[model samples]
Target: TQLLEQSPQFLSIQEGENLTVYCNSSSVFSSLQWYRQEPGEGPVLLVTVVTGGEVKKLKRLTFQFGDARKDSSLHITAAQPGDTGLYLCAGRPGNQGGKLIFGQGTELSVKP
Candidate 1:
């Protein structure tokens, strides 16, 4: 079974601060995705990284894939209260029957 581990399981910061979250695994993945979720709603995909060393940005948020495809990171700059939510990283393990292995999830709170 594939397992993903996330670091800094919980984060709290003042508005306009910067933060970074990490997700790692020993197994390689076919593709990896980042998602943002709010209370009472399903997670919304933020970005997908397929190639090693790929980077994607959505406004003040940035996502990066590790060179070996075994890790990923999300960075938020000038975070605001609206950015407070659950962040998740999920991976499609190589030949793993199409099931996604998800990280433990990061619960972030940005206080204004």
Candidate 2:
């Protein structure tokens, strides 16, 4: 099974700051997805990156997939206090089963 490694285990910053979280793997994924989970709720899908070098933006958050499709990054601009939560990166690998492999997670705390 391929492993997804995410960086910056935890992040804390003032509101309006910019941040970037990275997810990397040795295996390429067929589809890579990013999700955000609030304190007591299940994660909600944020964005999905499929094509290599594809870039997608949702509001102030931007998602980018590496040319090799083995790496991805999420950049949030002017992060707000409401953005505090756990961010996860997961994907159904090209050769893996139906199950998705997820990163350990990155906890973000944005203080007002």
Candidate 3:
């Protein structure tokens, strides 16, 4: 089974703090996507990393894909209250596209 394990299931930080979340798996993936979900809303796509060792950044957020295509990371700088949300990583296996498996989800609380 393809499974993505996310570390630090919960995070609480004050404004301006920095944090990093990890996603790992034993199976390789064709592509990996990062999402952030707020209360009463669906997950919003943050970034998608397809190439091994690829790096992408969105303002204060940085994302990296593992060289083995079996892991990924998300780094946030200067977190603010607006940054609070559930962070999830999903992977597509073998080009199939019915449903995307999600992580347990990391709940983040950034207090201002």
The C-alpha lDDT values of all candidates are: 0.95, 0.94, 0.94
lDDT minimum window of 10 residues, candidate 1 = 93-102
* Best-to-worst TM-score order: 1, 2, 3
Q: Compose the digit string of candidate 1's lDDT tens values, residues 1-112.
A: 7899997899999999999999999999989999999999999999999999999999999999999999999999999999999999999988878788999899999999
- Supply the TM-score for candidate 2: 0.97
Off by over 4 Å in 1: none
Q: Give each model a TM-score.
A: 0.97, 0.97, 0.96
Task: List CA RMSD, all candidates.
Answer: 0.7, 0.8, 1.0
Candidate 2 deviant stretches above 4 angstroms: none
Q: Give lDDT for model 2.
A: 0.94
lDDT of 3 by residue, 1-112 (tens): 7899998899999999999999999988989999999999999999999999999999999999999999999999999999999999998887567567677889999999
Candidate 2 clashing pairs, residues 3+ apart or interchain? none
